[model samples]
Target: MSPPDTDLLHSLSAELSERLKDLLDQALLGMIRPNSASQFAQHAPELENFREAITHSDAKDDMDFLRNFREFVPTTNYEPYRPYIAKFFATPCKESDVKNMFAPGLPYCLAVSSMTSGKSAKTFPTYRPAPHLLHHPLYLSFPHSEGSTLSPSSLGLWQVLTVECEDGQSSKVLPVCAVTVGFQRMQMNWEVEHDKDRIDLWVPGKTDPFAISLVKSYRAFFILNALFALSDRRVATIRFLFASVFVNFLQYVEEEWPLLVDCIEKGIIPDMENVDHVRESLEKHFTANPLRAAELREIGPPGIQGWAVRVWPDLKMFIGITGGSSAASVPKVTHVLGPSVTMQAPCYGSSECFIGLPYYNGDPNTDFKVLPVDGVIEFLDVHSDEPFERVLSAWELVGGGHYEPVLTTRSGLWRYRIGDVVTVKGFAPDDGLPVINYLHRRNGGLEMAFGVTACTESQLTNAIVSASKRSIGQIIDFTIVGDERDTPITYGYLVEIGGEVGEDAKMAIEQTFEDLMANNEFRVAFWQGRARKPTIRLVKKGTFTEYRRQKCDKTNISMGQVKVPIILSDSTSKEWFLQRVIMEL
Candidate 1:
């Protein structure tokens, strides 16, 4: 059943919370193990036929779907086939094409893949029979539906809609337009005509929207734009809004604390972005209730511990993506939002396909049940030497096993290796499907001693966060690069912080990083004098931002999608970062 239309003013009502919770519970009721198995079997014929048809040019009669897929399908990489994929589908309109180049004839809309893979964005499409090909007799009974009900991959929209907002409005509003802040985009509109269910702060966009170009300068301008465009009611709700990405949220708060306080302490909208109507509306709202400003100040500053709920008493949850590498930033976000806001990853997916649904009773890591209806999934054991040949199906996965997923989708991507490694937590009691948690990217980590012991991006990020919190004040950004010049071959850490860190503090941080990695087998190699100790070098504060700007200019990709390469692989990029080192931390 659809949730009752809630007033933004009455978001904190107990009635509303219970209703939303009940809706979520009903959605999870039908996901039984037998049902999941039946769903997989139902899609098997379509999956097998698609695989066969795509590889027909290089047909192998007795080819095994698991083992021989690599031999028949062209390159698994999506770059070269872009032109063909676009041409294969029909256009929405002859004169005006889709912005992301999704063909109108496809069953579902194209979702933009996250550029977090350190590669350009690719269009993620799912199963559908080609319109022209449907004229054949065999295709007569095929369904002419728009698409499946399930959103392709980790859409994260469900969390936004159900999670209680301070103003009682669903996070989404139809009239909300994309507000560009430097290279980043915010889900807000400054126009006079806007939906009544307006968002107070940032909301998740089509992309994560945490671009590399959103530095201090851009943040300052973004704050001013927000202040000028919003009135007392919207400004009052600032303390309750959830940002799409944790780092982006933290940066925004750090840069705009003073402005936030001013809006609360006094119900005044500064005339900055020429939105006079907003200022007048706020003045009228404040005039009606002169004591509202004082009442808001009584709750105290949001930057302080436990102030999130105190500032906005009705706020139910802080929903956003805080898993994977961004896990380190959770504590900081919680410190501001307080423990009342329930933060969660909600689902697991990628640019390629929406893979899993959130298991409600799962662990805090947000384990998900693989949705067989999305596509045919194959699990490759991470520890296996010959992973391809030993690929496991959905039912073949065992609890505690780490496997990289290979998906065969209707969009014509057969046996496409997703590169992400997910750990099989266990099967859900209700649904017999494997419950999995995303671990890290296969090759995306700090390499040690010719791949003897590589640390995942999250591990590296955790070490940096822990060490920085103990010694250095806070880090702006960081990256790990291989130091091939050293005889023993050590790793070099490039860190950017607000101010200088003393030698003693730097030494303490480096030691702490080593101590944190004591559990890893790399410690034995280090003690045996094989792998040298990693060094930490402090770069200028804006070095990473400058690198991103240069990269965007060179690659000609949108600056908004550019992400900092956590592990510097190329010699040219490594040299560029090394050249800007200010001190050896």
Candidate 2:
């Protein structure tokens, strides 16, 4: 029943050829996308300047064929992270130390320690506002086990509906990450009513091809990382060699010809399985009541499928998705203008820096501009022994830039270090302002966030210390993990036991957190909009180390490289309760 070895080789060759052909086509399209660009200029005012950039290349770069097929960049605001340098509080700011800092009309930032959600979120508006109730869970969706599988929510800022179905009904809708599709299956959810000239937002599951195929290619990158890191020495070496060769081939595809990535490209093949994690995850969450999605009794008063949300009344199942970096159906924001948008992927910040965000002219379909506030960014030599933070002694309410932002807002911030690396992309032509890009997160600043300004581990530690009366010795250590992203309840963290605290003591600690956070001013300012209580788990000794090891192994990262690990997982983070380590994994 097995295919012959010759046939398998032939099949792979054909697949490779097909992939190559598609890449070539996309590349051609990207280069000559003049017609599309020409048409867009009339509608979007922001593109007025870029029109020259669009037509700058008379001939294809040929080199950028694959990396940037069709010369099209889906308007995004991802750039390098900003490094933190909160220098105002060289010493921890006590309540009194900051009491006189506030004046009328001055922004009173309530920075809290990130130990417990109540303290961190309740202490800041960004962490616990109404929007946060929708976005916080997203911080919990991507598991280290799952490679780059994110809900489409993070793409909410740039959602564009570009498809139409047979039925003659259509309206702009946000992406799945922003709101639920009400359909049990993502496939059905993508079925949109038709519109005459409007772009459709109802993207079918991966089956429809186009962007899905491009997403599928990402799996290869993930596999490459895994193969490169395999425990087997010889095998890993061989895989690396093969990967190097493939990289050359891929480079050829990117540089010479670029159109093949799209499923819609001529001769492009289907590879739906590679990019269906978002839909599949949704299914796993709702398979118990599969029929719940079939509430479209056409004659009935707008059934469940008619709304963005649906309920399986009998099973008491409520289905929704947390938005992140997935490619899925969403609405078009052609009319919103650009100021409201922020890029998702390359948010600017690092360990010593904490206040950088993405730049979208506020437009969802364009490149981002990085703008760091005076106190948001800082710089350090690559060989520095410790972070030498740079900051302004006072606040600059009016934005000014060029230097890496070194922030010390009301959040009780001192000379805190953010770790984002950056390069000056350019000065904004429109405003003559500086723009930045978010590189990867620096090695030492990563940590769990319940949407609380992406709170840091040390901040959380301080909060826990402030909340608990027990000595630090009683609590050896704790790890904060982001839980489910699209639920009534948001995040949960597990604590590894060190001291003699038992259930009674732990209960007392939880009460302490609730009492202090509920009453704290910073907590009130930050986490006022959230509703769920953060779940805390007390674990056995050494459990924390084991977790760190597994996490390190999973991420292919060395221990001590990153100070804290943020669990951006939607599934396991939400479901798995604490497992007592009778034995370590």
Candidate 3:
């Protein structure tokens, strides 16, 4: 099929923009309430039945409910699940003990946790059915697989959460970049028979082909998405994989602008690389677009500086989870995409459970409507004087309450502390459910020598970003670890830069970081000579990529299940990164 013309593309863009606007508007109006309630109503009873079958109790009252749940199935932390990581790696690999212990005789597929917290990865059983491709306010309908026994191919969009079920099925919930509709299928060489009950999947021994194909498809997707959006004069709101990945892509485009222009003008794929099948459709659109090339050149220079705005002038915002370790990349996104592009985290949760749905308001921090459907939510109020024992129910939560959410899901996790802390905003007007905003992870805060949390994840991220922007080169990735090599404990900031930094630049980076971080308890300790000043070090360009690779290798988990650890709390990981440091300040 021939590519759509500029005029047709413009019309399509207008239609899409309107539809997107309508969907977002519905979300703000609490359209997600019914689904949350309905799902919860359905799952809550089934869970009760399961519990009754196990514990042999028909507890009906609230007192009975609390007693039965607490006594039969005790609250849990990540430590209890850590041993299960080895279950996946054992000879003649078997299911985890937690799986049998919690939900005995229940079939489940392991959803590998994104190891954002530390080096260890947690394997959680998923009993919830895959999300259907239905028109719902809380979700965006896109081309995706129906269901499968196999987990998402490591080659698939790892950034998007994939829910794998025991009943030979898998489904992705989040709306990632929509352009790669058939890319996964093509990469895996899988045939989807619409008539069949389940899809046949394969595990590839080598993933290089899929990885190469994905890169090509994404490059084309970005360029074409921007090109058409530019022609249509519409601001496109796209979900990005990460700010760091986007930054890296922009850098590549800037470096190879001439080649890109030449390829587009000649209707050829750049660096072909056996990805012809992947880029075939994209190439058709790129065909002899000299006019488009000229327009692209006229907009701005081929670099990060105002480049995104120049290419995608109507680009509205980049939606992503910018909390936790991903915070540092926000400044880079602003620098590249220009300051006008709003960065928003519409949804919040982890692999363990999908806790919150997007609740749009005027506030800068996106409000999430607590949807305790697939999972039952219990809040541990962090602000209470007697915090440990006082775990509050979801409905009992009040505005201005600070909480650490505990989840009990169909997966058989009973009151599991998810390691996150959130601040309760007001309740949702329609449902009266507590609307919350993510604050930070409990363990992500920077600890000082005197056992005081001097800086939060956001504060620490800001300091690193600010320092890098001022003195260090463009940051590719970074991590901070507690340095306890000596008596006066300090933290180490290891950053991977795009370019080399001089000795003066290194000292300036460290000094700038110290100044930015001085507003906290660490400053007082530093002034009193009780604590050593924090150190900054530069790692190799691909240090983070290597780290992720090593993690995958060690755990026998897919690359999709790993993330660049922001706060290296584990001694082994800290020592590994420290050994790879090229320079220190």
TM-score of 3: 0.65
Tens-digit per-residue lDDT, 178-198, candidate 3: 212222332333323321221
Q: List, residue by residue over 13-70, the lDDT tens digit for candidate 2.
A: 3344455345434433432233232222223333343444445544355444222321
Q: Measured by TM-score, how close is model 2 to the native structure?
A: 0.26
Q: For each predicted model, how many residue pairs clash, with residues at least 3 apart or on different chains?
A: 4, 94, 5
What would you estimate as the lDDT of candidate 3? 0.53
Question: Model 2 off-target regions past 4 Å?
Answer: 1-461, 468-473, 481-491, 502-504, 507-512, 515-534, 562-570, 573-577, 581-585
Can you give the TM-score per candidate against the true fold? 0.60, 0.26, 0.65
- Poorest 10 consecutive residues by lDDT, candidate 1: 150-159
- Per-prediction CA RMSD (Å): 13.6, 24.5, 11.3
- The best candidate in terms of TM-score: 3
Model 2 weakest 10-residue run by lDDT: 325-334
Clashes of 2: 94
Which is the better candidate, 1 or 2, if ranked by lDDT? 1
lDDT of each: 0.47, 0.28, 0.53
